[model samples]
Target: MDSTKEKIFRCAIDLFNDKGVSHVTLRDIAEKVGISIGNLAYHFKNKDYIIAEAFGRMEEEKMNILSGVQQIPSFENINNQVEPLLNISKKYRFFFLDTVQILKSYPAIKHKHQAYVENSIRYVKAVLDYSVGSGNMSPEPEDDKGLYWRVATTAWMHLYFWPAEVAIRGKSDPDIGEVKKMMWGVIKPYLTEKGIHNFETIKKEMYASA
Candidate 1:
């Protein structure tokens, strides 16, 4: 995309994240980009289009982050992944929250949101399968393995929603790390003895490097 269109999308994302789609006007986004409303409209026909494009951009960035991890992540690599996830949460928390809050107000967008959720589940499952195949995780029965994927994806989505509360409060919640640990607990029961040992070693290595 051209720089001008990129600037408009960035500005719109910021405004949507802060004030929400319903609360923000096209003029607000234009003012943010130091462009006339006409110029902004030249790139996007309407606010809905802009909102869709903003989310599309977010999805692109998410795919890039995931794709860059060339192998099953150890705890050290986990930290690198966490940084991008946290950055995304900080940047777009409000937009995500607002999208959920106004689901009834935009049925088309809501449908798209549902599709994205399903796609995310699939993407996460693929990653988990890759990790298990590479011996990062324990082998399990097919049924139980599917359940693990579901659990992980569900936990991840819940975590994404959490950042919205933090964004609204303008402070990091002290319990956030604990929440992450609890989510990890979902897979704890499924780990083999060797997997458990490896996980502990990985955690120790992660802490030592920290």
Candidate 2:
């Protein structure tokens, strides 16, 4: 939380986004922060330690974003959820892409990656539970089908990562509106009749606001 520590984390995140994690070293972060490696070490013990801290910071930011949505009164409104996710994609586009790329190299960070996946699943499950409880969904209590839908929806949202990385490579930026439409198609069949109506109403409100 110290200003210097925050600077180091931001510098490390930028470097990791520009260069793959495997290619980044503590020296790179230290140089970026304009601090000595020894000084950096005074805050973080090693490269892995710094990487873990960076990931923790990312998780914290994500939780904060989710918390903002959780405070919204209407869980049945898809826009209330989707909008924050789009905001997250826009703000942390590079971070998410870099994290996915790092995850592909599972052999190097197997345990860390597994922990991240498990934590992500738990976070998503909590959101799904909230949605169901708040009348956004009609899933049977703790049913496997309900669980599957939640997990699948989470994966569907992750599709944004592909377009985000592509845009980084000079391809077209992702259209968040189109992404919402596609996601709605995938989510519609799972919703109850009331849920469907609520979804449509939310969609109309979203468009009207736009």
**Reference-based lDDT, each prediction:** 0.67, 0.63
Each candidate structure's TM-score, on Cα atoms with residue i matched to residue i, is: 0.78, 0.68
Question: 49-166 in candidate 1: lDDT tens per residue?
Answer: 8867766666777667665543544534543575576676667665567766656765666887777677666655665566577676776576664676676687566556767666
Tally clashing residue pairs in candidate 2.
0
The 10 consecutive residues of candidate 2 with the worst lDDT sum are: 69-78
**How displaced is residue 198 in candidate 1, in Å?**
2.6
lDDT per residue for candidate 2 within 1-210, as digits (tens), equals 559887987787778767757788999999989999999999888766666665565566656655654565353433556666666555445546666565565435556655655655555556556667767666654546555446554644554465455667786556556566666666556567667777777677656654
Q: How accurate is candidate 2 locally (lDDT)?
A: 0.63
- CA lDDT of 131 in candidate 2? 60
Model 1: which ten-residue window has the lowest total lDDT?
70-79
Model 1: CA > 4 A from native: 69-76, 134-136, 141-146, 167-180, 205-210
* lDDT, residue 7, model 1: 94
